[model samples]
Structures are given as structure tokens and as C-alpha cells.
Target: MNINDHNPLPTYHAADNRYQEMKYRRTGKSGLMLPEISLGLWHNFGHNADFTLGRKIIRRAFDLGISHFDLANNYGPPYGSAEENFGRIFKKDLLPYRDELIISSKAGWDMWPGPYGNWGSKKYLIASCDQSLKRMGLDYVDIFYHHRPDPETPLEETMGALDQLVRQGKALYVGISQYSAEETARAYSILKEMGTPLLIHQPRYSMLDRWVEGGLLDVLEEKGIGSIAFSPLEQGLLTNKYLKGIPEDSRAAKDGRYLKPDQISGDKIQMIKKLNDIAISRGQTLAQMAIAWLLKDQRITSVLVGVSRPEQLDDNVASIKNSQFSDSEITEIKTIIGA
Candidate 1:
């Protein structure tokens, strides 16, 4: 579908569906409230994928009360294609419901070649956001984030660009992803000093990955900055998809760049099997149990999940229904995963 280059903003109308069934949690101390499970266009929704089907997934997500949509400058396989594809759907269908949506885009990863292409420099961050807005066909994003920390660049300069984006009305709030506790605290202080507090912190927290529990959670709790975890399923390793070995259509088999075959060792598979057994005993699928485990932490504002098909979205959303975990189940899960 071709989105109008000069499309006008349409009137807002909330979708009439089971909106109240999905839980909405407060984003830390912020006034914004996000869906417990937010949809992200990280792996799929690219130019290489079916744009029509991608649009359907997005519409279905909104209809299911998943108002938050996450994107990045380099999300598409060819880079910038996901945002462009979403721009088409936005103008065609979602523009009218923009008021009911929380659209976010991030930068700070390698997008273009050359010196100013990557990092957290003011030039790169600001220009990247502008390019993202153009590709998204929107005036401003609800949240703009630095995808990762750049040790080469000063934190002051990086946080300054985020503050400037808010001042210019190009972004409502700012966030940082994949940053350590020290880095988050420094950036938080800098943004707060500039009078624009850091809104959210995106990390990779899953049943398999527990690095955030080290000190990141403590720092965020102290500062009142919300956290949204990406890859909460650990690139699908936390699910039954890899229990019998990698399938031909699995992410590892399709895209070896992010998840390689060698990465799935015998020990990892054994751990997965054990975890799956625990999930079965709990009367839930491994995917459901994994997502529910992350939601157990109240500090986690949302879990940003990727979906290649509609069924995957349905399965992930169903996780919320069985989020409660017994103390014994938690202990067994930790022992199985060695967490």
C-alpha cells in the first residue's frame, strides 16, 4: 500500500474491542501508562517481508490494546525500511488513531557508513532522529531513544541531544537502551539537570539473561526511570522452538547473523528442555512462562517483543493471563536455568 506523502492527520477513534482486558502499567514515575506487553518491529516488518501482512499484524496489535509500537532507524534488513513500511500503514490506517498510540523510534546503532554515521554524537543523534521522523512520516515521536551507549562519545553530549529533541518538540520523552547502571545514572542526572528527565530505560532481560538484575534495577528504582526489556524471550531460545533442534524457518536458521547455530550448544539445549519441563508442570508453555517471569518484576514497564507472524503475537499476548507464579515454581525455574 502506498502512503500519501502529504497525508493529513485523521481524526482519532479508539478501537472498540477488549481494551480493558489487557493490563496497563504506570511507566515508573512518569504520567504515561503503557500496555503490559508492547509490540516491536525489530526483526520482521521489513522491506523484505510482506508489507500487507506487516500492516495486518500492527492493526491487530492495536486492536488488542497494544498501543505502544517500537521502531529504530536500522530495524529493517536493508535499514530504514521498517519505519518506511510503518509510515505507509500509518498514513493509510493508523494515522487517525495516533492519539491512542505510543510510537517510539531509537538511534545510536550503525545505520550509515562513515564517521558521523554511528555513536551518540549530537550530530548523529539529532540527524538520525530527523531522518527517522521523515521515514516514519510523523511530526514527532512519542519517545526517542539512544539505542545504545557510546563509550567513545561523552555522556553529556549524548544526553544533551535528547534534551534538545524535547525542547524542539521533535520528541516528547527520551530513553536509553543497553546502558549499564553507571551509564544510566550519569545520563539520568544529565537529563534531569537539563530539566528533561529520562523517561525509560530499555534493557535485555529474560529468563536466560539476568544481567539487569545486577545493579540496573536498583539504579532505575532509585531514580524512578522505567525499563522496557527487549529480547525477553532470548532470541527464541527460551521457547519450545529450539527444544527438538533448530527448525528450517527458525530465526537461527533464517538469520545466522544475530543467532548462530553454534551458539545453541548441547548444554543450552539441555537447559531449555529442563526449563520446558518446569513450564509444563506449571500448566504453561515455555514462552508464556518466560514472559510471565519478566512481568514478575514491577520495575519492568513493558516487554518489547518481536513477531514474524500473527500466531506468535497471539501466543505472546496470552502470557499475561497466566502471569502469576508460585514461590516454589520460581525456585524451580531459577534452579533449572541456573539463575
Candidate 2:
């Protein structure tokens, strides 16, 4: 378990009981079964963060049955730095467990400042896949997602690139993130025709945000497309950290990139406190309850939870201990979230 400072060949072997606690769910109709809770590298895996800490989170998560590690080409402060750091960690710790892992990378947002650096064009996607593979030091990722739908790029061309990747052995499964029900249907049809079944859909789902409940989740269920809910805590809004008010070190105080202080207004704070009370009644932290709420739905294949520290990861993983909710609790939660 100790790292040889001289050679550093990554002698880390995950715990034998890694798969004992968490249950794996089948992705849509595919044979792949992801852990109930997956780890996403959207934060704290960048260059600004300590590489050692990031590596520790990955190792501990693996030991806790988090076999899926989600990443993207544009996921770091300096763009592809997260993938590069993950590649380094792969060499230092996870290379041996590669087969046991389900790693995914996305490309659809603006990566570079040029024209071809963004969107769903085949050119950009193909090149970005190659770059991501190089940065992650992997031969093929389990899933490669078109980060978002492009209004301009033809769906055929965009999905065709993913088809090519699968055929070329660069990516095993293809998915779409943030695609609406209509767009997802079209994309799925095209990929299906191209011989690559759309594996899953990544969407932001939580108590605070119920957009997925409108029609997207239904689309996924009807089409047998698996779903992994991201931001299930609503960027920390659903956690106890903002129940009283935003902390000085919260993501809102320092960085307003995605979360803003104003979003945690008086009304929102009150709601969060009420939700926390409900969570406490369930014998769980608000964070754990938030995740458990998502897992209550069998259609939701997994929940992508991101953490900065190993303790945070431990808390998130404990959510699986109580993933069920009574019908009365669900009704109360819906009323509380203003549904």
C-alpha cells in the first residue's frame, strides 16, 4: 500500500470489499452496470488543486465501490489539466485497476478559442477524443459524451463521429449530456442507425431543480437510456452549508463561476433548513439525503457526486445505505421544493 518514492510503480490495490457495499445498476439496456454512486472530476481535480489529494479521493472512492470516474476535455481551470492529472494518477495508482473502472470524458463546450475547438462537429469531436485519450493515458474510454447538443451542427454528423469512435475502438459507448427530450430522441435514432446505441444521458437533477422530471426522464425511460444525475445537490444549494447562510469558503463566496451568493437568497436558505430537518429525521445528513432521494428512482441508473476530500466522498457514498423514501416523504419533499 506504500508508494515507493524511488520507483513509484503504483502498488495500490483497492480493498477486497470494494464491491460489497454499493450495488451496481445496469446502464439503460446495456450490459454495463455502474456503481450506484459515481465520482465526477468536475471540481478539485484540476491544476489548482493538490494532485496528491485528488489521487487520494480517487483511491478511496474506488475502495468504496465508485468504479466510474467521469471527466471531460474542458474540465479544468487550464482546460485539459484534469485529464492530464488523472492520467498521472492512473499511472501512479489506477493502471492496474483499469479494467475494473468505467471512465468517461466529454467534449461539446468551447475548448479552444478557435472555430473548430467547440461544438459537435465530427472534426472537433474526433480530434478531441484523440487528445482526451492521450491526456488520460487510456486506449479507449467506456463512454464518450457529446457534452451538449449543437444547434448548428447536424445531428447525424455529430453522432456519426461518436459512431466512428466506437467503430475505431476509441470509445465503447456514446452518450449525450443536457440534450432535451426531442434532441435526445433524434440523436438516439441516428446513433442507433449508425450501429452505436445511445448508452446513457447525463442531466442535472435534484430537489432544487426539477426540469428533468418534466419530460426528459420519461424519454430516457421509454427509450431505455440510462441516466446519471449530476448536481443532485444543486451546486451545494441542497446541502446544510447554506442552511444558515453561505459560508465564507463556499463555492459561492470565492468563485461565482456556477454558484452565486444571490442564488442562496433568504427564501432558498429557509427551504434548505427545512429540508435539512427532514433529512435529520431520516437519520442522514442533508448531503446524504439529497443523494438518497435521487437513488429512490430505479430509472436513475446512478448519481454523479463530486467531492474535494475523501471525507466528503465517504459521506456521499453512505447515501446508498438508505436510498428508499416513503410515499409521504416524497409528497412532502415535492411540496417543499415548490413542485
Candidate 3:
């Protein structure tokens, strides 16, 4: 029997109408459907965070119709702690509803010290998926991704491992994140020829950062691979929190690891305040506008959002309610963004 079997916890029956409000979009041409707003375990579900709070946030996300939970091998401050903690909760709270969830993990960044630990290689990819499954206490993940491209490793070998995982019953689908448009095309061709089509691509996209717009979106569209926008708020740059100045507890201030204080330049702050005004005019927060803006592009499968609190989930998910943009509204937004 599982060690957690004896531990008592609050009952977490999902909301009956959880699927009613939220819309599901097909990932690429595949049958897999993901919620419009998927929750990411990149920030709050780490080791140093409170376990109870993590559980609460997860439960709230589920209650709000978020069935997809994204994770990575190097997500935690201490590494693997998010998955370790989530595994405990899964065994306890979400075990019975396992079929209702879509869990994904990646392994491209530096997950360990050794040279073999990081990057995409046949051995490293396979081993990292196993480790991730073990940490999440799952038999298989819905989608296992190559976190990033490895210029060192041959694409054929990396794609082969992903294909092998699908055939090995370790992963239901495979994806790539942070690959360039050309690289994504090459991967898609290789994977398709190998008889294991790439399902989706995750890219860093927001009003502040629009690199994906150049050709990435078109590539995904032509290739029939879905795209999920990560950091859609640009590490909170597109939000009102940084309007006046960075708060002491803001991600830029506290988590200098990825978001830095210097990154918040004066020009960006002026742009954020302008975006905030538009958000207010639309009766939504700047964060919501940023999210809604991403969703406006039909090619985007979903906007992967990271929330520190349950209320933030409520706000982000609400963006879907008014995601439509008028001709002039789009023009105005693009003008302000200098697009």
C-alpha cells in the first residue's frame, strides 16, 4: 500500500460544471484537447513554497476548469521538488481523477551537474522522462517535451527518443519547446517520417516579446502542430503590478534568478501603464489583456499561464470570456506596442 494512503485530507471533488464555462481547443490536428488557460508549475509549486498552499492552488485550478498542469525537470529552486511535492498530492487527492488530467514534463535544460544530464540526447531524454515519471508518481505523462534544442546532439537522435518513448508507452505524445521556426520544421519532418508526429510547441510570447510572430506561428500552422504561449505576461511585465514600480515581493525583485531588476527599464514601464489604461477601458486587468491578446491568434492552442494565487487563476481564465478583438482595438493595441 502507498505510504500516503493512511493520511487523511480534505475531500476535493471537482466542480460538476467545471467543463461548462471553459472551452477546449484541439492540440494541432490531434485528438488531445487542452483548456484555453492551462496552469504552469514553474513558480509557486516549488520546494521552498508551502505544501498546503500548493495543494490549495492546484485544487482551485481544477475547480476552475484547468485540467492541464505543466511541469519540468528543472522547475524547482532545488530541482525536482515541484514534481516530488505534486506526486504526493496526486497520490492523495487527484489519483481517482487521473484520466481527467493532462500532465507534461520536459528535459532539455540543465537538470543535473553531469554533462549527460542536460541537453537532448537519446540517453538523457529517456532517462529524464523516467526520472520525471518517478517524481510525479505516474505511469506515463500525457506529453513529454524536449525542453530546448541541443545544437550538439543530432536532431534525428533526439526525435528518435521521443518516438521511442511513445512506442514504449512512457509518453502519450511528444513536443518541443524554445526551438526556432526552422528547427521546429526540421523536427516536425523528422518526427513525421519516424511515424511519431510532434503534437505541439511551447514558445515565449507576449506583447513585450513577439519573436514568435515573425515565422514561428506560421510554421506551426503549416506544420499542423499546436503552439502554447509561455510567459504570456512576460514575467509580469504586461501586468499592472509593475505599473508604478517593481514591488519588493514582485518576481523581478524576489526572483532575480530568471527575472532581473535591470530588465524593468523606464520605457517598458511607460508602455505597461499605457497597456493598463487599455485594460481598464476594457474592464479587465493588463494581465488579462495580455492573455486575451495571445488567444486572439487562432493558431495558438493555449496560453500557458503561471499564477502564484488562486485569484490570479480566476483573473487569467476570465480573459477567455472577452478574447475577441475589434478591428480598431487590434489596431490601437498594435500601435501602442509599436508592432
Top candidate on lDDT is 2
Q: List ranges where model 2 is wrong by over 4 Å.
A: 1-10
Q: In terms of TM-score, how similar is model 3 to the real structure?
A: 0.96
Given candidate 3, what's the lDDT at residue 326? 85
RMSD to the true structure for each prediction, in A, is 3.2, 2.7, 2.6
Q: Can you write out model 3's per-residue Cα lDDT over 136-239, one digit (the tens) per residue?
A: 99999999999999999999999999999999999999999999999999999999999998999999899878999889999999989998889999888888
Q: Which ten-residue region of model 3 has the weakest summed lDDT?
A: 1-10
Q: Residue 312, candidate 1: how far off, in angstroms?
A: 1.7
Count clashes in each candidate, considering only residues at least 3 apart in sequence or on different chains. 0, 0, 0
Arranged by TM-score, best first: 2, 3, 1
Estimate, for each residue in 126-190, the C-alpha lDDT of model 2 and write its tens digit.
99999999999999999999999899988999999999999999999999999999998898899
Off by over 4 Å in 3: 1-9
Whole-model lDDT for model 3 versus the true structure? 0.89
Colliding residue pairs in candidate 1? none
Q: Could you estimate the TM-score for every candidate?
A: 0.94, 0.96, 0.96
Go through the candidates in order and give each one's C-alpha lDDT: 0.88, 0.91, 0.89
In model 2, the clashing pairs are: none
